[model samples]
Target chain A: MRTLNPLYPTCPIRNIINRMSDKWSLLILSTLNQNNIMRYKELNAAIPDISQKMLSSTLKRLEEDKLINRKMYAEIPPRVEYSLTKTGKEFMPAVDMMVNWALEHFEEIVS
Target chain B: MRTLNPLYPTCPIRNIINRMSDKWSLLILSTLNQNNIMRYKELNAAIPDISQKMLSSTLKRLEEDKLINRKMYAEIPPRVEYSLTKTGKEFMPAVDMMVNWALEHFEEIVS
Candidate 1:
């Protein structure tokens, strides 16, 4: 009967939050927010079952969006470290909210 | 060095939140939370640019997940309305957290 309206430029709030509230982005932020910085491998371990492809892709997205900064070290195997930018640190409040929500609402899903 | 640990059964927390925190789901919940119920056409008007396929798909997902209840009316041209379930209302606090986060961090995206 009517058209579906997506939040684009004018309603970028939903658009941007959609970016941060995704599968990998949520978990990736959970990992980085607790540490000053983490190399790629350590971060992967922090998240038990993330794929390399998804991790790399998610990280790249956060990097592009300025949520996280990636620093590369010249090494035999190439070392890289990831840290949340100042802008990213602000997002942690939302992340904390999610964690608390998860713990609080965990029972709802089971029942 | 390691595989992506996508949150599944053990980590169903992130998995479930991922389902709730999506493009249409977020906006749709935002709409329904403000109102007890809304007809299909009425809900469409609330969101400015959502597509028919996505709205239908997103609503269907939320319905299946039990976040919202869909009621069909025996009326001309077939009438339907959407409402959030008990579990759905429980999700609103987390949604509020997101809204607050967005308002606080809106400048980061453009800066």
Candidate 2:
């Protein structure tokens, strides 16, 4: 049996994987991967049917884990944008594998 | 961005993977993969420090997800043993990959 090393004080990779598998995070990261930065609302709108609350929470956790960067440009309307951190981009292959695996096998998994 | 298919109206593979990463499931399955079947307390004891409730809940979830089979032998002490289901075994390669990735990359991911 293998033991997990707790990351930082409280973070665990299991927790990280859970956050990565969050219904919104995969979409959000995949969306942001194309563009360096994306406005919060723009990303949300692009995700198609994600709840605002879910998007907010998922982004917050991803940022906390340093997987995504949340930058606020305090302009006229307080613009906030999200982009993948180096760590987040590194996991792109894994996440892409996950998505592709999902596409290929979810039907088989479901049936 | 890739879209996730909501599996079976509720059971998403994301959910399944989350459960698979349940801190106990991987160890539990890895333990059982060796012996094919084991009693609840025996598996718990083999896990070193797992709580009874946690083992129970994890096994219950695995059973509910059809990843495992629980056979209760109507003995004087009410013997019960757990074994992996067919679908569960198919996921062995993926789970092994996860464990290897965790063992190999978790340190890098942490620091």
TM-score for candidate 2 = 0.63
TM-score per candidate:
0.80, 0.63
Reported per model, the fraction of native interface contacts reproduced equals 0.33, 0.05
Candidate 1 residue B20 C-alpha distance from true site, Å: 1.5
lDDT of candidate model 1 versus the reference: 0.77
TM-score of chain A of each: 0.85, 0.79
Off by over 4 Å in 1: A1-7, A73-78, B1-7
lDDT of 2 by residue, A1-111 (tens): 123434323323353354465546766878899888999879877775678888888898778667799998879889898899887787666655545444454554444
Per-residue accuracy of model 1 over A45-97 as CA lDDT, tens digit each: 98767799989999988887788999999998998999998878887776676
Evaluated at residue B24, the lDDT of candidate 2 is 71
Interface RMSD, Å, model 1? 8.2
In the range B1-111, model 1's lDDT, one tens digit per residue, is 112124455454464677778778889998999988998888888886788788899999888667899999998989899999887887787778767766666666644
Question: What is the number of backbone collisions in each predicted candidate, taken in the order shown?
Answer: 14, 0
Instruction: Give the alpha-carbon lDDT of every model.
Output: 0.77, 0.67
